[model samples]
Target: MTWMDEFWRLNAVFLVILLSFSFQGAHCELVVSPVVPTLVKAAAGSTVTLAVSFSGAPDPTVTWFKENLPVVTWTIDSSSPPDIAPNYRQVLRMRKDGSLTFVNVTRNYTSNYTMKMTKSGLGTAVTYFTLLVFDNIQNVELHLQPDPVKEGIDDFTLQYVMSQGDVEQQMWFFNAKEIKTDSRYSVEQNSLVVRRPKRSDTGQYTVKLENPFSTVETDMNVTVLYGPDEPILEARPDRPFYLSGDSLSLFCQAEGLPQPTAVWVFGGENLSHDGVLNLTNVQTSQGGNYTCMVLNGQTKEQRQKNMTLNVYERPSGNPVCSVQSVNRNTGLQYHCLWWGGTPLAWLSFPALSNTSSGAGNFNLTVTTSDNLNRKTITCVAVHPVEQNQCNVTASSPVDFLPAVRTTFDLGEGKIVVTIQCVSEASPEAVVSWSKGSEAVISGSTYQISNNTTQLEIRYYNVSSFLLQKYACTCLNPLGSRRREIQLRGPSISDFRLFPNQARTVVTLTWEVPPASVVTGFDIQMKGPNLPSENHNGSQIRGSSNKYRTIQLKPGSARSADVFNLDPDSTYRFRVVPKARITEGKPSEVQILGPGGGLSGPAIAGIAAGIPCSLLFLLLLGGFIYLCVYCNKNKSSRQTRYPVSRAVEKAITAQPDSTPHNLLTGGLKSPPDYNRLHQTPSDRSVALPTFVPPQPVRVATTV
Candidate 1:
């Protein structure tokens, strides 16, 4: 062939190959009409078609399935009719293009339909369709599980029911808003379940049932029975306290489903039935707790709130002001008092610039200056309802008469000393007793009688008693006076020992009464050894631990000096007053060696350390006791045999009268078998006497 002929031939072959590929590509591409599937709906007596179209093969084998079951099969190019299943043979029909048609459609024909196509070269193409047949959405009703739902308690359901048609889709709405399924709400088939409905759930609820052919909606008005919330109580012209004849008005409010009603109660009496409680000309008897109770008629729930009212009265008549002298005529006290009122009246001294207001009773003290004499003071009393004033005049101060009397009485083989103090003053004085610098109260040694005006010293010992002085004082807010009393007797006073720098040589001094009372004084000394020299410069070495006497003549100075004493030894010295016929009690003193005593701080440290040491020891002993007890309990638990529950119950039921055999019986037998089988009259029996075992003692030689 020529070159042009060859080119034409190659072009022809290439064009042919391209044309083959184009034809294969066009035929192999499967296209289904309306790629997204949609539901189909029709009336029961009407005809319907589940339309599905695909272009993959010209003579593909087509099969239709209803809910995964093959209902019909047909070939597009076959001349014979389509094959249909026995159940759908009467109502179902298939076209040559593989579309399903339902003739005289009934409610039973509604189902899911799937169309699948298969050819030799091409694989498979599948499409889905849902069919629903309905007559008409009529006689539709929404029923609730409970006619009246209880909030926060009952689980209620709203079910949609139709007598004529089937529902394809259902939706719920509350108060015009769609209700979404959540923890509190759920949709089950045609029912809407509300778990634990609340008060907020009370409203109009709508359920919409829809199919492709029709949509129907039903609404229900649900009222949730709820509580009458805590009543809101309010009072007009509110105040903490009110005066007599005051008016009061109280109002109560509450919110509930059925419109709660309020009732008023006070002091166990029904005051009112309405929300408003009015009190006109209220008296003190009406002051108390007032309750307002709100109730819901439908829910049968009630709530109450309380309010407190206090009524007071102003003071009657006039205030009284009095003046008295205090502090031993050095100052004057002016007092104002207003009594007989519900609440105490307020009193103030306007003229006294430094005084503040007081309740009921008020007092003002001023020094006894020239300005205070015969001065008139005014006391003002104020109350919520009224006010009053009074005046008092201060007079010249009066002097008080004070007297001290001593009386002697014999009792219990001893002489009792009684000291009495009498003071005549306005606003009576308080009497007190003191020994030296310390105040004394009634104790075993001293007794105070007659409202603290008389003091009795009982069981008197002359040696220690004569060394101290007693004082009685009569005191008031304004002033005080004191009187010193010394017991009359031939007794030594102020007995003291003065030690030298070496603490060996010492000097003794004392006080004594007149020479007529005491004839001569005898100085007695007892120690390890007698002093080598006395106050007269006489040397004497007496026997060890023997009493030595140093005599002093009457009218002599009460002092003595000793020399050459042992510093390591303790010495006791006694001074005795010798009367004309009888010897008086002796005053004694003891001197300790420098190395023989503990200091004050050391003694205090020992005293404080004793309790702490004792506490620690007590805690240690408790811990050991707890450990022993726990171990003993553990051992007992380990060694004890197991007892049946029945036996334990029986033993507990009749613990004191349980027989010994019942305690030791084996677990195979029932507890209290005889008691259970016996009649009431035959239950009583003779109980055997129990004897305690004696303890056995074992003796061993050490």
Candidate 2:
């Protein structure tokens, strides 16, 4: 095969491999950088880091060493390296890229570091790092104390610090034996806390200081310091509300002879260096307890305090409610709502339907059937504050069906009436009956029949005149209605007014009572008034039954305008209402237009009383409502709730007691202040001493 043919065949084979790769992730390749770099200024107990690049794999292996003595190998991970002391002393960090680090390196660990790349082919490449170790990073320091700073846990804080350093300074805590990196003995910043304590943490501890130039070892005594009592965490504002960038002060009160050093922690990270803690911008995440620790070779102590941080947010604007009428007969329901920073909960109805609206709203619904007139509903929003709550109320208009208070009686009759006619009109209506323009007497001879607005002349009426002309009139302000009486005996002339349209078929004339025989003369008419055809008003039919009523010559007029009409007509018609509780007295005849005739005194008295009775009913309703209000709230008259009880107590608490001190002494024991220096004897070195020297020289010569 030609070269091209062979290449194509190989290429085809590769395609099959590529398809397999699609189903599975590609295997990873390991790559390392600074293949031949010279590392500088590496400090002890601190990491000198480099990069490890990888591709196409689940996990990559990176093994590092200095001069092959196996200082430390990062064989399993892409990031973390285990502690191993070696002759050449190498620390390998397994990472694809950033934050690749050497944790807690020692001065003795400096040498040429070589990295091996083993991927896809034991691909081996060696990199040279000229390691430089140093001991002089000015800003680093360390101290040992009780780990949690509590009175109980054996662990203590081992603090090491550099006043100023080029990079982060790592710290390691090791007793005479092995490395224990469990939480009981872990490292934070430059301090090692022995959380899970063992007696092994009490031996001669060694602290190694390293830089790229040299490494220094400091011997330490991890003696047990009596841990402090539990710390009381305190603050000026017990319930804290903090704005961004505001100055907030928090203090930890711990029980110890020497004052405890305080460290603030947030989001699991420590905010302390050289015993100084500062907060710049406050956020909700900044809330937490602060730990104060105190320690030396002999004494260790700590305290923790809780501080709350609140972020301020404005309340939502007033809420709007919507109401609609479903069925007017049922009633109205009002909805109220508002939004705020703090979550709002269930709503309440402190006001009755008649009282209107209430304060402090969440979402409230009131059952009220609105009268067709638009009703205004009010809603209020309330939220919690320190001592008192804040509330804002607003009103909006709503529509609902009003309670129907129509005077509910319909006069029943033998006549057919459509009840539907009442609902279709704007105002309600009333029904009555009349004959030849005269309203019929409501009694046995002229009774109503059927179940509704129907009227029937008594079938028992032996009087044949019962079959005379009559009308059924339904009255209302929107309109008025009257039907022509169905004539029974003969054709009758009927007329009515317009706006006040009625045609009275009868004219009136009454017997002049002989100043004696008059029992209030009966001047009855065929209808509500005198007829327009006065003289011909008298109808003569077959017997008295067919005779239509006629006007009394003395009392009649040509027009039906007899009501309130004067000089032209002298007659007026009136009917006493049938009594429900009392027998109604008959009405007396009255003449219009102020002649020698006037309305009877009884009629005038009845007219004046109708309005006065209505006022009495209103006053009665008001008195009943007042009685109910007084009865409902009889005890513990407190109408408002209070909120600041806890805040008041925190202000009255006491301040803490702890001493402030700095100790300077010998490395192993306390210094004796009384005998720090021995006085030099001034009377010394006498002639005796010179003579003894001369004698000794002569004896040696002999």
Candidate 3:
């Protein structure tokens, strides 16, 4: 067993030596710093190096491929320069080390790169590089969803968009601070999502896009639209009530994304449009509920708050106190009043210790036995602003402001006299009238009206009415008063004016009745030329050549003659009698001048017919004488002589002596003296022929 085992072991050792020698001669030991399949990144349109190093070969070949297609190749100690593919000829570069480099790299140059090192007698070594050519991070923009984010009601997103570059990592920053993902915040591929945005989250947001070669960032401002919180209203001087003429101010506060605006409403109308409300000199009419409303225009939200205010005022003046009689003049009532206030004033009597609240008037009653005469009474008025008082004195019933008035009217041949009396007293007075100790009653002659305050007396004869003496009495419970009144008569009658033959003198005459109460007479004469003295020895002047006045004593005669009158001028005379109480009406008369009557031609004709008239009269007389002589018996003689006697009487009668007839010419026919004293009715059977007098015309030698 030893000889056969020994022979096989020698042959196996010899075979292991021979195999080790062959492996050593066939392959070299090649080494590389990095393992195969390494990853590399680059940005587009920029310079990059796919860095790799090997220590086994001195001259190694580096080759770059894009998707398994060769782009470029470089080798040291080569007769020709490095070779670049037609697509990458202008942008391919080679470094001194065994690493691949690219100038102005593009996205299309992303692929695997293989490096192989080989020498004449050494074994070849190979390494791989996985290249990722990414475009530069450019055109980075941050966009917000919904444009404007809403608080508490909307989900918002912040996203980034790029045009050419790729991103390896994405980050979000809020106001320069990093944002973390949570339940409310989520990070997607290139966006950050917020579940529900809030007002506190409103600010600037930044987003970053990162890769191996470059990083790009973009910023955007985010605004959260929120609701206007419940509005808070406050008053400057907080109070439930305010006095009149006081100033007030109000403020409203709210919060929102867009600044909120406030409006003040009062009495169903808008008052202010800002946060502050101002009122100067407030009044009672302005008291009511005031509402403050806040609005957010962006969020379309509104809130409101309300407050109430009250205004008060005091009475304008003091209280008034007065006393009046009541219960048939048996008792007295004291009254107090206060007026003009927002709320009713409170009135009271300090002396009586009585109060009447929430009212403006108070009254107290007492009997006459209380002895309140000439005593002072006080009334107090209480109000929110101030208190005031007034005083009054009580007095007994007495007459005051006593007055009497009298007037006269004449119409329809009747005279009326009205007498009125007035008197004032605390207790109303009773009025009574009497005429000469006789009570005046309402009858045909006397009329009483106006609660016996006016008395009217009617009479047909003015002479009888003037003789009455009326007395008016006003009586009350305390005292009595009386007034006396007397009336005057009317004008005088039968006023006449007489002119003498020369027309140079005139006489004025008037008569007063026996019942008249005349004291004197005032005679006024108006003419072209007046006299210097009257017939009664009274003086008169003609200074103005227009008029003159003469006054006579009561006992003087009724007739007055004016001397030194103009012969060619006319005159007018007026006489007014003065009575003890009043003046009578005036009586007027006019006296004509010398040439005021008949024309000159008529006078001449009358003178010419005088001779013919005398001749006719002579023949008529002769016939009458013959008839009388032939009738010798008594009866025959009486009958024939009646005509003759009448003729004789007409020739021998004198002119009338009255001033009226003397001023004018005498009557054209003779008047019967027997019928002068008879009335027209009594003398109807044997009426006398009356001829009116013609105006006097004196003969002038021209």
Relative to the true structure, how large is the alpha-carbon lDDT of every model?
Answer: 0.70, 0.40, 0.67
- What is the C-alpha lDDT profile of model 3 across 1-702, one tens digit per residue? 698898899889899767755754575455554432378776777787766666545676656566577776777556667788877778777656656678887777777777665554656666777778886689988889986777888899988887778888888988998889999889898899988999888999998888887888889999889878888888878886788889999898898878789999998889899889898999988877899999998777889989887677877667888777677556767788888776667777766555443367878766655356557778877766678888766555454332322233424444455666766643445678898888889998889886777777766555666667778887543446787766657457788767777877677788765434454577776654343454665534322334456545352358777777666555567787754335678775554554543445965765565566557656654654454345323333342222234433543576543222233333233243333423433332322233333423222211
Best by TM-score: 1
lDDT of 2 by residue, 272-370 (tens): 633445555655346444554433223433445555455433335545454432233133344555544433422333443444444334434333332
TM-score of 1: 0.45
Model 3 stretches with alpha carbons more than 4 Å out: 1-37, 45-130, 312-702
Q: What's the C-alpha lDDT at position 572 in model 2? A: 32
Candidate 3, residue 259: how far the Cα is off, in Å = 2.0
Report how far off residue 390 is in candidate 3 (Å).
20
Candidate 1 lDDT (Cα, 0 to 1): 0.70
Off by over 4 Å in 2: 1-224, 236-240, 243-246, 257-261, 272-305, 319-335, 340-349, 352-361, 370-378, 385-702
Sort every candidate by TM-score, greatest first: 1, 3, 2
Give residue 199's lDDT in candidate 3 (0 to 100). Answer: 86
Order by lDDT, highest first: 1, 3, 2
Cα RMSD of all models vs. native, in order, equals 46.0, 57.2, 22.7
Give the Cα error of residue 523 in candidate 3, in Å: 48
Model 3: lDDT of residue 47: 82
